[model samples]
Target: MELWMGFYLVSFLNIARCVPESSYTVHLNKLSFEKAQNYCKPGSFLTNIPNEKEMAKILKTIWDENSKTDTSFWIGLKKDKGICVEQHLTLKGFHWTVDNSTQSDFKTWKVEPPVTCAILRCGLLSVEYSHSGAKSNGFMDTTCRNEHAFICKRNIQLECPRPEILSSHDMIEPKNDPYTREIVCRSGARFNLTCSKDLVWTVAGNENVDISQLCLECNKGYRRDASGNCADVDECKESKPCEHECQNTEGSYKCLHSYNGNDINEPPQPPTTTLKNRGNSVQTQPTSPPDDVRTNETVLHIDESAGDISNIVVPAIIALLIFIVLLVIVAAIVKGCLRRRSIKLARRKAEAVALNGSSSMEKVNEKEET
Candidate 1:
């Protein structure tokens, strides 16, 4: 029994590992913060600047150089009122979209927006490039109603972006396997595609040319190295997504936990996320649920959908409240102005009436004297 169990574990380890380096998509299509998050659904979420390295990588390819100037993109950070820490040069009072972790290692602020406005609690990443080709990036507060270009980040493996098919072709879908991210859906102009016993897709007539090679695609969690083999990337040295210690293993790496510093008596930071309402005395619960306990597709989808809805709905409610307040304020101002003008007009009419009456009386008196 032990031998069989050991064999199974080893086989599972042999399966391809995902590179810890996150895959990012910079969406130039402007959207509100909640809308942008919903748009990133199923595969990715809004990016939280995890570390200096990730930020550097993003700046190296931030859309284009010209658009980098005067650019602001919605990130995954938002202020939570539940957190009480209020200090200069900090993002500790906020929560990130992924994992809902409020503890941030990288919190660079250019100018902290005024702490009095609750409407400006959503996180915005202001991006720009200097004349010397240096990039300046910082986090600032903004209303969620504002439309802006945003970023989406996937911290895990990704399915291949569907290859474009220009000619008549057929696609072979994977059967029974859910984890492999190879080119299962491929269409070709000249030949049919088939997956061999070794899981390599081959074109019908061209045995020498692998269709995956033509697509320049590699399996998820791997890239083609110098020898053209799909080798697993050492993300501990490269990406370093772990908080504590990283242990590089056979096909992947593991994050060893450092059980120090945190208070054991403190409640675990999961299942319920606390959010901060800066400058306001209200502590609102954020929409992030406990981490997914299930890895099966159906269960995962249900949990993720619930969390996503929660995330969007709460912010939406807050935005609606803000809109209502603004509408009321404007309505009151217009009403006050109109009331004063009406009173002024009434006073003017009364003066005219009195003056005409006096003039008529004087004319009558002059007639009597004559």
Candidate 2:
């Protein structure tokens, strides 16, 4: 009897364990730097630093929905003020605490970063300890000025009623549609039914539906032909639907029109030119040169003098000008050398005259003294 009681208790615990107790709800919003902390529930905390496991879970949930919104939120971890600390973790996943402050013992630092005064945002995770019931962790500093939605968690325990077995004949078959059928229990029996087919059925006002008919039919842009096959509805076939070109896609069609004032079908073409192969087999004997060709030759002859200046006279004139420039440069160099020599000679003569005058003045002074 004791063994049977233990078995019943074990079964009860197993059933309870299978039921979920907590539900998480995330809030998507835009908040300012300081106001992001306010967006979370008051008792809930933000991250001072984010752990790898927590970060991975948060990223997986956000990316699973393929959201295009760009935002970051605050975490609980923060760099401690005035304390420059570097922490290293051991093999047992325990991190050595560096001295942050003499008084403060709460080691809630933005993870793996030295303590500083830069105010950073943190993410909060709610943890339920076995003995402590519920508590919030400190925040971590993530990238600044990024916006992200925050998740909130609450514990909710569900109590399911005891199940009672009923007789087979106690089931009632509701008479609704002749094609579909439903088996429902009369009050006290366990709410369970087995269907041969895997299709899901929902009860609405005593009607049994296979659920496939309630699906919406294809609209005007989509084609649902006689055999109930869906295809693209070609709008172009219907009375000049597009002003330009039209292309059909699955269930819809697009009209192609040029935005830059161009016709869709008619593109601009290059000017045509006659291809003249110098050694071609076929040749037409010209009766006379065209009037246009003769006019072109006359125009070419009128500019012959200018053409001669550009081809021959211009090159000769450039050579002559180069020779004159060379001569002028040589003359200037010779004149500069001569001017430098004259300046040097004048400086030497001035020095010598001063020295000779000083000597004569000294000799005359000595003679007068004697």
- Best by the TM-score measure: 1
Q: Which stretch of 10 consecutive residues in model 2 shows the poorest summed lDDT?
A: 294-303
- lDDT string for model 2 (274-315, tens) is 455668645444354455532111111122344445788788
Candidate 2, superposed: residue stretches over 4 Å from native: 1-22, 32-34, 42-57, 69-71, 79-85, 89-148, 155-370
lDDT of 2: 0.42
Q: List the residue pairs that clash in candidate 1.
A: 80-275, 80-276, 81-275, 81-276, 81-277, 82-275
Q: Candidate 1 residues 87-146, lDDT tens each?
A: 653574667877787666677886666555244468888877676453646887777888
What's model 1's TM-score? Answer: 0.39
CA lDDT, every prediction?
0.62, 0.42
Model 1: worst 10 consecutive residues (lDDT sum) = 294-303
